[model samples]
Target chain A: MQNHKTLWQIFAAPILIGVLSSIGLIAALVGDGWWDGISWLTLALPVLLYFFFVLRRRRVNS
Target chain B: MLLLCITGLPLIFHHEIDDLLHAEVKPAEVAPGTPMADLDKLLANAMAKSPGQVPHFLIWDRDDPNAMFVSVGPTITANPVNNRLVRMDAHTGDYLDSPDVTGRFTYIMLKLHTDMFAGLPGKLFLGLMGILFCVAIISGIVVYAPSMRKLDFGSYRSHRPRIVRWLDVHNLAGILLVMWTVVVGFTGVINTWADLVLKMWQFGQLAEMTAQYKDREVPTKLTSLNSAVEVAAHAVPGMTPSFVAFPGTIFTSKSHYAVFLRGETPVTSRLLKPALIDAETGKLTDSRDMPWYVSTLFISQPLHFGDYGGMPLKILWAILDVLTIIVLGTGVYLWLRRRKTGVSTVRAIAQTSAVEAPLASS
Candidate 1:
């Protein structure tokens, strides 16, 4: 069976990475505490999204 | 170029790597409200370490109070690279004979990443490589558009040949990394030209800052180092100084001390605003935000280093850096893979169909 990704799945990586990086950037400029927490989450997001690529392959293999 | 950026991965977490190696010199944590160490004593202690040298700057870490970094050189006008740095115990004024972090592997990686030990020419060559990298990124995007228009973004086909699978993943990763790669690339290139920007700042902004004091006799009797810092801090309320440049240092005016203050917050901390103060009087002489070029250089620092955010951001940068290496490697692989494969599968079929259609019509 062929793997056909939805538009959301296709666009997910760039959108999440770009938007979160922007958010992280904004949060950094907004100062610390809550802003720092937001910055950390947003900046760490693309790395987390990467795991989706891994899990999808694993599911297909199993 | 791939190797250079790959080497920079460890450099992204240099503080952590350095801390792991030199745990003892991590600046002993002191009890809260502990009387801060005296700057003058620290200076005397530091000078004793290297006699016959006049210190260029007295630096106290805004975040850590346990140690001081005192830079000294042959003369005040010497280039900063010629200066020797001595770290002193801020509390007890004790000199720690420790493994220098600058001599460690991370530093080597930094040298490899920045200049390959070739100095300015090497840096400029790397800057050229960075521009090429930007060009590659732009071309890669344009090249991927037609293929990606038909296939959904990130459509990696595993059942296909190995090269094809790699090709698909390469495009996916390349597209994902476009923004990040471009931003980092531009910032990295800008960072390489830092020396030039600083020299320009000295030629223009610093000249303007010290214009009135030009041709004036160098101040002989200096006031309290602590007092100059206080005056600078007072000039910009609620902000602490990052470093103090003594009267003769390149950063300071001839007759005034340059007390550079920084905001405690993440954003403002990257920007260092210098408050010029009278060397003999400890009075604020001039205070202004850094010029745009210098500020751009400072802001590019966090984007290039990825240290501004935290450990998590560094990890993210490392991951992306790895992916970028793969993208670069696969790009070469695909170009090579085409050598044996001849024309692309789509183009081959199109050519065959063109001939077949003519025969059928005849």
Candidate 2:
């Protein structure tokens, strides 16, 4: 189980990231105007959050 | 890591270099009726002086007073190597000496960065390398997930092996640049097939051009290509001409001349482009903004390369590229080390007595 991650934890980051990215992409298609401003941040947030959560879990266990 | 570092460094400053080398000239109002014959006469006399060539495309100064450019190639070849752009007076046929294209550092950098002079084959090869780079980045992330399980996002456990130090750097770079690398990699793959993309765009997006001219009066009358060009300037004010596609060429219809315009701002910069002019009357009949896919390609260009922002952005790009190179080196190193260790473990097991070996190994 050392390498195993719970289903929720494993899927959480990707799902959240996917949703944000999808919003940005749809906003881009629809000319939402505001999405253009924060599009990069939207794309990066999920990946960063995933890293943060995983690192936090590791530190607590150690 | 090494590859990332090198490419990242150049990617960071590509825009800066572009800005440093060229000054923008916005087009000024010339008489709508500026005779194209004058521009053509100037170019014709200039080309005749050169040993052997015919013109391919003509470029006009978008902003300068009395400036035009003629890009020519040997009349008989499709090869781009023979192509040359001759700058000339727009109103007079006075030839401006061709800028020294050879021996320029920018040209050398572009050649190495794009194709390494092997041309298509080299581009295809580099594209494959870009894929390998993508794979290395992905795998580096996979390995890092396990090691960083207990550390903070930027935490470096210095007490670990030299390989670990390198691995942490590799992981951080790969993770940070995951999206960027994918975009650049995919785009680089598409660019390797540049000729195909242009052909596809011509036939797909501008299918209207072909249909429009099919029944129209053909502009076969040699109305100095430059005249149609000036006519376009009259129609589209503040538009600087980049390249012109002639009638009967694959890029245009029999009745229209196509002129590409360059954009002026950081965001509009990549999107500045093609306007269609009536070949016969020198009227700006129609124009094309970049399609979605092409626009995506354009915007992705700066993000993927990290070249749009100023010097600070460039430094960031360089750091990221170096990190990618390190990731690649560490990946290769890790693979080799794993293989060696596997072999030693097998040897040690084989040398032990049967019961003891099995027990010890377990």
Candidate 3:
């Protein structure tokens, strides 16, 4: 098995990102009209965060 | 997989792009609450200019104060590809403009996407493509089950090689999106062959509803379009009119106006406005919810296109669609890599598994 940090590096980030995005998506679907703008951010935020997490993890692992 | 990825991506965003681009589309002026008779007169005047063709459908803009569009075609025919468009002043029914839409981008893309632009051949090819796409999706799911069986849902084994890493991502996306993708794909298949589908549905359920009317006195003096629209509106109060098919069209008997209304609710958005007016009396002859297949068509549109929740929903659809593209690309990559490794790509899963059983089972 890999080190705990490596495991976190490999899994936690993506899982967290997916869960966060899913929440935002469901909220956008069922949320009040006032929260509409935040919905787009919710969809886009995960993709951006995932990229950052991957790049930062790569640097640290090296 | 390739077909679904390509076709599904555009479908997912069709609403977004159409809305963004349609802002430039200038709507013709229409008089509010114009009587159905006057609207019919206006349509007649508009059709008089287009001489050789008979009117098919009349669309009034619910939002635009003075805008109406009419589609006309050669008499005694019902092919979607061969129709002509005429825009007129809704209040006066005077022909304002008739853009030569024979080879426009929108029409071209629609034709290509729906039927491959080969007419019957194109439609048949697209039908085949839809079938193949469905098969690919099923096969993809079959392939996913074994791999996903070992790993937890959404799990990604990143310690594997690049190909395996990508493969896990592909599997996860595919399995998660399977239900949505299948819904969209099946509906897309139904839509691509809508003319046939509608006919089949109509013949099945509508045959009973229309059986009595078939023998009734068919009136030569048709009720004006204006009255018919009014009668339909009266039947379904608060429903917004989507479009109205004039008499002598496929949507209705030679003596009726079929006004398709839309409900304001999310559920109603897919159910559609259904009011059939007598051809001669311009009065409501029948009003009811759409038949099952028609309702299926109605609801499938927003679900397939992912246009339900507005801009945010569209953005989410686009991202998911892009991810799907990546998954498709990775699948192709894995196949190519296996080929490079001297495995024949044509082998059935069973045969391939037999050979690579030792490798894959591990």
Candidate 4:
């Protein structure tokens, strides 16, 4: 397994996604259209990623 | 606190549940370009229903287009418990349901979620709890970072010891839900302070807005409510009147009516534009954007309530809420389990001998 780390992993990703989720929540409340789309995607990102990884690993192992 | 989250999950889906439980009979569809039922007629009906009482608020539901809810009270500053609420067909002026039964239960859930049946002190106490919860989440993140550096994101070490595995699960879920927890928690804290904030506005901006009319008498022979609405609409172009606050209400002065208008877009819709009207003349007195303090509270509501993106977003909110409950439960579990074995009789004995032996040697 690769042990290398990057700046994005250490700093950018967490902070960016964290801020994005907040924006998405606020925007969704502001009204609709693209705001709603952004809300759906950002809010769903984490759990979606978790499942994505889990299913991919299962398939590979099987 | 656990009870708060459990109760809050139902509240996230409160719209669906409330609609289903207290469904009003929809008014029959009218022809295109049909004029709305007269506001004056509805006001009269509301007054007739509650003799001697005055109308506090007239709320038109934008989503339903033909539904409305009105609150009538004995006084302008009457506590919610003292108000009589009625829902009606806005287009037809027909009483769909009067003497609300479901409203009490819904309000109880809100009060419980808000202050646990206590008032301001309860609100302030919950605000402190929210701050502490935020602190816990922050400290958890700090402690979690080093472990995270070693493992990939979403790592849950099933093969590890029970506590360690739990720690991993806790970290993953907590981090994933961190944005939500912070937003909800922070907004919740703001909401707990909403009453105080509104009072501050009343003392400051509202006072200034109504300053000119302070000496005026309570308006008795008022102008038409429809005209007041029209004046407010004209004052704010491209926006629709959301509600009307009658004279002598806290929302307005003793001699003026306050017509609250909302914009079509999302951001402006939450931000109310209030136009003060001359109660006797049906003429606009002053109109301007509400101060930031009041608007901030208004904006915090939907963010806290998750009422934006319909069913899907609410479902997402519920899921995150459940995940947070798990994280919180596991945290308490780990702490109690460690305390039972690590900090009790065996550690006490070890500590005793260690202290005694060191003293004796010295």
- Which has the greatest lDDT? 4
All candidates: interface RMSD: 4.1, 7.2, 7.4, 3.0
Question: For residues B206-314, what per-residue lDDT tens digits would candidate 4 score against the true structure?
Answer: 7898788789987769899888898889888999888888788777888888999988776677788889999988888888787887888888877888877877788
> TM-score of chain A, model 2?
0.52
Q: Taking the tens digit of each residue's C-alpha lDDT, what string does model 2 give over A1-62? A: 14555445443443455566545333332332454445545544534553564465457656
Candidate 4 or 1, higher lDDT:
4
Q: What fraction of native interface contacts is shared by candidate 3?
A: 0.10
Residue pairs of candidate 4 with colliding backbone atoms: A30-B266
Judge candidate 4 against the unseen true structure and give its global Cα lDDT, from 0 to 1.
0.77
Task: Please write out the lDDT profile of model 4 over residues A1-62, one tens digit for every residue.
Answer: 35755545754556766887887787787668878888988898866754565455446655
Q: Give the TM-score ranking, best first.
A: 4, 1, 3, 2
- Can you give the TM-score per candidate against the true fold? 0.87, 0.66, 0.73, 0.88
Candidate 3: tens digits of C-alpha lDDT, residues B1-362: 45545555566565445556545345444456664337767878787888888778887754454667788888635674577778777656677777775555555555556666667666767767767767887898666555544454455555445765667667666655454455556666766676776777567654554566776544656667777777888899999777887665667655667898877655564577668887865667777776767876766666556666676677667776676677678778878877787754323333544666588668
**Chain B TM-score of predicted candidate 2 relative to the true chain B:** 0.71
Model 2: residues with Cα > 4 Å off, grouped in runs = A1-62, B1-51, B60-68, B88-94, B99-105, B212-221, B224-227, B233-240, B248-250, B253-255, B262-264, B343-362
Candidate 2 C-alpha error for residue B254, in Å: 5.9
How much is the lDDT of residue B115 in candidate 4?
85
Q: Write the per-residue lDDT of candidate 1 for residues B181-237, one digit (tens) a residue.
A: 787888899989988887787778888988988888777777877777777888899
Stretches of model 3 off by over 4 angstroms after superposition: A2-62, B1-25, B28-38, B61-66, B89-96, B119-162, B215-220, B342-362
Candidate achieving the largest TM-score:
4
* lDDT string, candidate 2, B137-175, tens digits: 566556555555544455443444455555555555455
Please say which candidate is ahead in TM-score: 1 or 3. Answer: 1
